[model samples]
Target: MSTTLSSRKRKRGLSDAKQSDSLSIELSSLSDTQTGPVLASFPYLTLPKNTPFNVSVRGEEEGKEFVRCSSTIAGETDAIEFSGSANDGSDGAGSRYFLALHRPGSSKLILQPTPVYLISRQVKALKNFKPTEPSSSEHFQARSMLGKVFGTKKAKAAIDAQERNKIDVSAMEDVVGVLQDRIDEGTENLPTQEKLQDSANAARLIPAYNADAERPEDIYPLHNIIPEPEWAALDSLLSKLKNAADDRSRVRLLPNARSDWLRQHLMLAYSSPKPKRKIAKMLIYASVMFAFRGVAGRNVPERSALLERLSPAPEVVVDGLLARFTETPRGSTKARMTSENETNLLTHLFSLCLKVDDYATDTALIASDLKMSPTRVNDLFKSLGVTRLFNVVMTDQLMFVEIASGCTIGKLSSQDLKRLGLPDSVGQEKRAILKAPLTFPKPRLRRRA
Candidate 1:
């Protein structure tokens, strides 16, 4: 009807074949660069060897027979050529060629390259037909033909990059450091508990007996490997995590029966009032992540060993510190934040804690550079604490996911959670986070009595 890109050249019902025998495919007059037409409008017909066919039916009616054609052209061809590949390699690749054929609905078959699946058989056999796109058909074909093309190393490399999102080990370390800095600064002001007993209990959380102050940077890799000697334990665990490709690998390692232990923690430096609670929350998160990493891969035993050896939080904590200090604050505080402000300022800080991105930019941090909480600031940490929980796992654990499974998204994620490699439940309704302006909430000055 229309003579533009939307219009079809041939009439609608011309290609609708009536029966199998009536169909006669002609390809004797094909030129190198031209597409030809139908010889006989039969529902079922076979192509002679070297007899090429091309039908221009971008949008045809439903429930019609479309030819299922696949070809392994030589290195170069005079005919119209296009590359084919799969979304993911399936059935060792090349075992199933899934090109869409002409029929009332979509169908694919695992055809041997030499003896391609016939349209007559495919159409007759396809019971319930579904609509499919050309791209999908192409992907199916490519996936089927993958091994016939690419090398093993090439495929593995592609998988490796995707699973870990390509996060270098050093970058992750930096992000953890930033969170540590914010968490460390935020707890500077915890309203000195005036009540005698409450203060006593609170002091227990932050033990004052620190003759040898432990800086976040001063953790030997051996710290997590206690009870068992460091050299023996680290070597054993490292081997398990590295070699845990299949179930057998994990089975060979790990203890026979041990409580599924995890060492989760949040290492950030925010100016929150209750540093103790923040530290507690950090530990909980680290435990969640540790459990996830421990059980992240193929074997339960290897997962256990990996998790045990992997809770090196100090490096991540140090990295978080460096990331927070690297950025210059955006020059303005006129825009104060409030808890009810629906403008997601505090969650951003939480994301920084989670290492979603490299910068620490919660709108609440718009106050002064030396963000000490003279009154209290733990409210900010509490405000967006739950939201931060998901992020911490998502960002931090993504690397391990890649390392374990060579994938980071899709069906693999649920598998990760089920194995205790990730938290089973997420998005729990925690307390609502509220943003507040950087007002120090200073007490009123007392007049001299």
Candidate 2:
């Protein structure tokens, strides 16, 4: 029995040895196949804090490029480390990694690709990664931001210069003399009085006026004048008017119920006993009008006349003269402009209607500047040979005026009319004129008287 058990144990030991030898042979084969490293080492990236970026690995599959893995590193993240291995087990051979950076307030994404090499059993890192310097556009954006927070340098300088030029009350006469001298010097190049008069006489005549035409009830609507208020609050209202987003908003700021409020305030200021108060009011009025000329429509003439009637100053007269240059006749008339200045000014203003940027001009803006009713401005433009266009954009009170190139100031040539893209005449019709005279006899009577 003992001899039989020993033989059975020997057989079992031989089977165990055979199994161990087969396992060793399989391990040796695997080692030989994987002589080089099976795992790939990729470099880690260190980025700036609060910088948003993305990292991606790309590889070619079937001759087409594709992303292998991607990760988004948000702002406040500073380091990027590989978390896991890829499933394909190709070790990213012949592949590249890229970093994508986002630009603030823009849809553009900046891509930076880096060539990757598989190194055996070693991790790589960038030793000299420097943050890129800001470009010129970025610098400009930064400067603009600073300007928004603090006023621009140019505005600051202007304010400082104004402060420096402030004068005492006693030097008012000298300042006036200096200003008059400057005005005279500037007018040296303007047309002479005789030339101006000749130009006025030769100017184009307006259309004949019709006495039977009726005027609209709202042609010259009365403004709701407000009494005096705190000067600072008045200034705030003026600022609001000036900074309004659009023409409609500006008009809303001074609706008919509050129209000419600034002028009313100015009159009240003039009535004050203090001369300084009067001057302050005048300056405020002038500044507001200069900044926003379209305010209160072209009723600047009415305001000037009122001021003149109440205050009776040389300044008021000067304001009236200035306003006269912008005023046009209320209705069409055969008469020429009363003054050479008016003719010249109207000619210049009409020329401005022809802009290089647009094919049409908004005559409503022109009418506002000229202080004429829209219908009167339209008539004037029609006399000047411009075609009025319908407002396709549905904007309120917008009258577009268009003139063909090479058209004369007051005449529309047949060629100009054709170029204007108007529909052709249906047919050419001919007509003839006939002149006839009738002969009548006269009778003599003597006895009745």
Candidate 3:
């Protein structure tokens, strides 16, 4: 009985193990069947092959709760159609489904519902539009109609003239205000008398203004200070100088005989028992003035006949007078003057004299000719060095003589001599030239300490 009971207990243990195995298999099979139906039931949508369309979802915030669909097929009429809800769920009847789009470039997928409306549009044909051409008869008719309305040509011209002259009184005050401002600006820095004189002298130096006046008496200052004979001789000499082609031609033109005649006359005037300082001074002034004026005047072939008459070359005398003004080159231990340097010195001297004349010149006219500003011309004057005296402008050397006792050329102060680029002995030498016959001095090398 004990053996049988043990056998029955073993059988019962085997049966219990078998039943547990069957229960585990049945549970796994049931789980697989439930997962398969859930996966199959997942919502999906398919589009027609090769159909090109753009789908976009409208958010609630935008006052829209639908998806928009747009598509275009060539040669087809554009149409829009709306599709209702895609799915029905237990939670909500007529539930909407969303398709997650994985755009190629986007990092995250966008969840959007299938587009409700499918839209397509067709391109309209272009139309050819052109302006209408007016017929000749139409133009004739228009002109005739206008002629009838406006009356005769004289009447039309009168109407046009009246229209042109019609003034706006309302804008006159504003125009006046603008003009007043311009006038103030123009007159604010009006040039002084000295400045005006300087500008005039500069204008005279320019050929354009010089050509306008033929006689030296009309343009030159202190022209009548000397006697008529001396003045005539000097004017004749200047005309020859103006007609000469070059420095060589000038030298050849004024023979030594003519030069000696002038020299003898000047010496006689100065060495007279009663030497008139005015006559001597006038001779020197007129000679120097004519020399420079000749240099500035335009060359004319018509004046060649006047040049044939014997006249002194004042340029030679003027050269010696101006020799003291040449500057020594910078960084040079010794002063070495060249022909080019002499030419430059003479040019500067001529310019200086012209810039410091005693007559007022129109600065505007000069500035316009030079295509520069009056201020720029003034700057050029300052660079050349000028002195203002009363209502006249003159060179430093002239000013020094003018302010000196007896209004005679005298020794300049050391400061002034240096400022004018002259040697210490230049003043004494210049004063001595006035006492004797004017002659060209020998060229010599200058030494700078």
User: Each prediction's Cα RMSD?
Assistant: 29.5, 30.0, 30.2
Question: What lDDT does the true structure give each of the candidates?
Answer: 0.30, 0.37, 0.37
What overall lDDT, based on C-alpha atoms, would model 3 receive against the true structure?
A: 0.37
Model 2, 227-336: lDDT tens digits are 13323334544555445565445444441213243333334333544424333333343333322233322443354443443232234323443454345566842222
What TM-score number comes out for model 3? 0.21
Which 10 consecutive residues of model 1 have the lowest summed lDDT?
A: 400-409
For model 3, the superposed segments whose C-alpha errors exceed 4 Å read 1-155, 182-194, 202-320, 323-449
Steric collisions counted per model? 59, 1, 1
Per-residue lDDT for 1-449 in model 3, tens only? 01111122335445554322111111112221121111012124333455433322222323232222121112222232223221112222343444544556534444444322222332234223456888986875576567658779886676566557878778788689888999999998998776886675553222212223334223223331223444444555555544556444544444332233234335555344565544444444434433433332232112222233213434333333233322346884433444444333333332323322211122333334334565654433322222223332345344212210111223455764565456666545322001111122333333322
The window of 10 residues in a row where model 3 has the poorest summed lDDT is 20-29
- Residue 374, candidate 3: alpha-carbon lDDT: 59
- Name the weakest run of 10 consecutive residues (lDDT summed) in model 2: 20-29
Distance from true location, Cα of 160 in model 1, Å: 86
TM-score of each: 0.15, 0.18, 0.21
**Tens-digit lDDT track for model 1 on 30-113?**
332232222222233433457443333223322222222222111112432222212121212354322222333322222111
